[model samples]
Target: MQKKIFAYIMSVLLITLIISGIFTVQTIEKQHFSNMEEKLVSASYILSQVLSEDIQADNIEHIKAVLSKVSRELNVRITLIDRQGTVLGETSYDPSLMENHLKRPEIQKALKGSVGKEIRFSSTMKLDFMYIAQPIYRDDYIAGVIRLSTPMKEIKGLMKSINGNLLLALIPGLFLSLLLVYRISISITSPIKEIKNAAVDITLGKLDPSINITSRDEIGELAKAIDFMAASLRDKINSIRDKNTRMEAILSSVVNGIIAVDSNENILFINPIAQKMLNIDEGDIAGKHLLQVIRNNKIDNMIKGILENKSFEENEISLNYPTQKIFRLNSNAIKYPESDRIIGIIIIIQDITEIKKLEKMRSDFVANVSHELKTPLTSIKGFVETLKAGAIEDQAAAVRFLNIIEDEADRLNRLISDILSLSELENRKGKTRYEIINTADKIREIISLLQNQAVHKNIDLIVKVEADVRMLHGDPDQFKQMLINLVDNAVKYTPEGGKVQVTAYNTKNEVVIRIKDNGIGIPKEHIPRLFERFYRVDKARSRNVGGTGLGLAIVKHIIMQFQGKIDVVSEVGQGTEFILSIPRET
Candidate 1:
């Protein structure tokens, strides 16, 4: 920039100097030639008057003498010519050797009674000269012509001297001009240099110490503008960083996993939860292709669909790589601002395995409740209709019909009660009234209540509980109910002579109760859903045996409410054992 400015300044000054020198030299030369012509013409006129008498009388010697004396005094060449273009006398050249003077421009004008002047190269003298001629008159008739001539060398010498002086002045003037131009250029460009550096710093994220130009000129205004731009950029950068920080925090804290990929399906960002959901390692996956990282065809294809369509979509997909997990995935195309072109894709994955299971459970619960209620109502309705339509006339038949109706109604009531209890347990939060109780005592009470059923079935019921396992913190009634349901299910399911045993023991952190029954054991397929509401391995046998189908569900819910755990081990024909772990002190 400095070089360019210097070159521009020097070029202008050099051109100005050159043009001024040419114009000055030309004007001075023109003025010099004008004055020289006037002097030559005047000299010619004056000598013509002096030489007129001599030319008329044809006195060559006298004419020659007068012409030579005037030539010496004026330092000009003198020529005398007659009207016939003959050279009469000459001071510098031999008169006989000269060309016909009458045909010369100046001599012809002199013959016409007018002074004429010309500058030409003389072939005879072999030099350049300025010539002036005037006619001499004798008694009003043209006698001869007198011409004055000056060598052009003298004027040329004067012009050369003047041009030399101009060149000398030009050298110093150019040097001074270049220096001034350099100073002015620096003044203009120095502020611009600072602004350029400041702009560079701003790009590099250095937003302090703005360009300092104090001059109240365009450069200073530019500096102020740069300062303003830097300030604005700093604020914008900080705001972006702050917003990014907040966005990261939000993404990190969200329960759903978030992942962003580019149009080419290259992962751009992956939140912490996304890493866990995708079963990816806790390392950087950015810039890696999504298929390479996750290897899930469904997810990759969904992202491709979003990119192609530039729209939003949601799907439920299962990942079987690390584990079997169901996820509800929402994908959206990320676009350039105000444009439809897709730049990337954003996907949110929410783990919905538990939710799906719960949904299935809810559907099954509705179907089972409807079936349970309908069967009993159908039975009661049939029996009541039988008694109403002439069966009442036979007392034994009517009594038997009433008993059948009462049993159906009682089963229906029990089914409805169990359903409502299970629903309350699931929906209610912090509704358990907890109290300290004895684990062994609860088991003994449950056994005593169900002893009659066990006796009727001819099954041996045994209770084994350690003394230290007595104390446990839970809802006393719930714990008692949980024990009764397990024992009753055991007795109800056991064939005659099958043994049912209840055992309670204390561990470091918990009290455990085990109910073992050598009944027709449950199938392996039904073990997973044994605690589900209304899920019976043998539906006909369970209903005929007066099992509500919700007994184990209620027990499971009570244990869960107490933050306890329950596990069941059952074999097809060997036996089944229900183990319950309750926090001893909680």
Candidate 2:
């Protein structure tokens, strides 16, 4: 701005100086010419009066002598021409070489009895001249013409001096004008520069409202307005920051994973839960494309569908990387507050693998229970129908059928009892009454009870209990029932002359019980579902051994009630072992 103002000032000054110098030179030139013309005319008239007698006589010596004296006095060239336009003599040039002056403008005018003046270039002298001519008269008849000429060098010298003076005069004025213009420019632009700097700080989020322009001009008013605006903007920014903090807290506290994205599928907000569920540890993934952040194509498609439909969408998405997880993905489009335009999307994920597994278990339990109950009922119905059709007439046949009916009823009763017991243990939630009982003693009692079965099959049964595991806290009946199930299963599965071993000991704050048998071992695939209700590795063999298939499941539930864990190790054609770990304190 200063430079622009100064340039304007200099331009105007230069133009003004140029015009003034031109006018001054022209005026001086015109005035000098006018003065010279007057001098020439007066000199010519005076010389004509003195030289007319000489000219009438045609006395060339006298005319030349007089012309020389007058020309020296006046410092001008004097030419004398006769009526016939012949130059007799001249002060400077040779008369023989001089041209006739008959057709000269000044001479022709002077011949007509009028004073004539002309400024022209003289070919003889090669100089500019101001010429004034007057007619010389003798007895009222024109005898000759007297013309006075002065060279233009004197006027030009005066003009150069005048222009020099003008330049000298303008130098100071130009410098002073430039100085004043610079001051004015500073006064105007200083405050603007300060305001510009303050605005830059505000853009960078430094909202300091200090501008030191104290004048009451428009610039000052602008500074005050900017200060007020900065205050308001700072308040708004702080309010927005507070709102974001609260929103982040709410998102972090939620149990479900939440993801928010923009219309272009760029991630805007992703909570820690979402990060964990997605197995991502890269911090600050916001503003990245959704596919770049989350690598699952199914979830990406679900988000796309929700955004395209601008409605809600729910899907069960399975993730195989990191770990296998089943997520119930619920997605919906976010819209403007009062308009139907879609903004982005909001997605929530809830893990539902456990819930699905429970549903499947319940469904399988219902089918197994129905099948287990129907088998015995069908057998009893068939036997009774046979007896009612006169099969009771034979005492031997009647006794055999009665015994079969009794055994079937007992098996049905055992199955029903085990099922009921399992249900009760499963539904039991809190701690039950637990008394500290001798661990070795409990194992001895259970083994003795199952010893008869082991002997019936001619299988060797061994019992081993650690001396240090004297007592553990649990329901003694449940503990005894749990051990009976394990030992009985081992004995029943072992072939004749096979060995079954039961061991109990203390391991790290828990009582460890293991039942091992050398028999046809369970297959690897069946171990995961071994404790499920009515799940059998060999259906026919279990039925033949009078097994209801609920014993292991019931034992598992009892151990769970005692806050214990059960594991099995088995190999085909080698052996099988069931290991139980129960807390010793409770």
Candidate 2, 1-586: lDDT as tens digits: 7678667777877788789878887988888878888888888888889888886787878888889999999888888888878887678788779888898898899999999888788988899877898999998998889888888876787778887887798789778877887888787788888899999999999997579988888888999999999999999999999999999999999999999899999998899998989888868899999999888898888887777776685789888888778899888777899998778888898888788878989998999899889998999999999999999998999999999999999999988888887887777654566788788988898888888988899999999888888477778888888888888888888788999998888877898989999988999999988888888999998998988789998888888877889999988888899999888863
Error of 1 at 182 (Å): 8.9
Write model 1 residue lDDT over 433-507, tens digit each, in one string. 878887777778889989998899899999999877748776888888888898888888888999999999988
Candidate 1 residue 541 C-alpha distance from true site, Å: 2.0
lDDT of 2: 0.86
Full-model lDDT, candidate 1: 0.86
Candidates in order, TM-scores: namely 0.63, 0.70
Report lDDT per candidate: 0.86, 0.86
